[model samples]
Target: MQFDNIRGFLFDLDGVITDTAALHAKAWAGICQRLGIPWTDALAEGTKGVSRMDSLEVILKSVNRQDEFTMAQKAQMATEKNDRYQELITHLTASDILPGMKDFITDLKQHNYQLALASASRNAPTVLKYLGLSDVFPKIVDPSNLTKGKPDPEIYQHAAALLNLEPGQCIGVEDAPAGVASIKAAGAIAVGIGDAHDLAQADVVFPGTASLTLTALRGKLEDGVLNA
Candidate 1:
């Protein structure tokens, strides 16, 4: 599973590379409050790796109002959530980047590995800049512009295409099951950044980025290559 031969690395934002997942949860909670819907951690977890509109639909379903809102109204609420999320993340700093990520990314860059982003968030640019990481990824696939999100493979595939690499030549890292599935569907090796069970579909799972090192990742990838 050695990543030595991998040409590019695709990373998911929010929970995978930063602590912004909490900020996103807060925004979702705020929207739930205005809509009189009960928000819980279990419910919030369902929105990870999903587009804004898809997240809104999850919220609407939880409140039993999914059918009540028209497409226009849902779009407005999604915009409202994004506005709130933008404000909350305005105070983010370098400390917000997940532990070990900076070092790992630098290591990858030193090895001449191309970097790209495959996140479902439309605010990817803003968040990257807020965390002082706007330069790391030159290729970012905007899921908002696509009709499909995670689990559809479109985003990850687009990221690989933009990086001028085939999906099999790229490794996609994510913390969400849907994201892992998306990468796998795109023919890329999926590196899960969360609980192994939660990301069982991933080729290999690391507890978190803090526990991942360039050497260890390469070892895992090399092993996968051998096994395959």
Candidate 2:
């Protein structure tokens, strides 16, 4: 359970770094309402850590309407959702950063641990800029170039590659189950920042960003609390 070889950190942007997941859900809800589709909690959860088109497919499949839209129409819908999301994120500021996140990131940097972003959101750089964290992540995996999203391990693998490290030499932090799965599948230690029950697959689950600390995480790993 010891992560002595861990030298890099891969982060998810939405729920892990900020509360933008709510904005994403709101935008998706608007899309569902426009399409006459029901927006349930399950549908919202299904979209977490997934790409925009993949999320749209999930929403369409919920009511068996996946085949009703052409690729061009879907593209337009995705663009509309992005527009709504952009509007919502305009209110973001440094205060939007989750508690303890800045300190933890600084701690990581001071320790010489490389950092990169592995977000499914294509607007990650903009979000980081709004949060006054434009320089924190030097390498951000571009979602547009990825052939697969979270739960497929491709994004995390690419993130590790960007850091010039093996997946086993990094820790991936996420707030979604699919993201945790991707990290684990990529052979990295998975750290969850949400409900423990929901992210049971993670190596260690902290309730929130405030609880994420290097000392505490190492303690957990040293104590062999791999699934806690």
Over 179-201, each residue of candidate 2 has an lDDT whose tens digit, in order, gives 99999999999999989999999
TM-score of every prediction relative to native: 0.95, 0.97
- Those runs of model 2 whose alpha carbons end farther than 4 Å from true positions after fitting are none
Question: Which pairs of residues have clashing backbones in candidate 1?
Answer: 1-220, 1-221, 1-222, 1-223, 1-224, 2-221, 2-222, 2-223
lDDT, candidate 2, equals 0.93
lDDT of each: 0.87, 0.93
Lowest summed lDDT window (length 10), candidate 1 = 219-228
How much is the lDDT of residue 173 in candidate 1?
91
Candidate 1 lDDT score at position 13: 92
Supply the global lDDT for candidate 1: 0.87
Per-residue lDDT of candidate 1, residues 112-162 (tens digit): 999999989889899899888888887898775688988899999999999
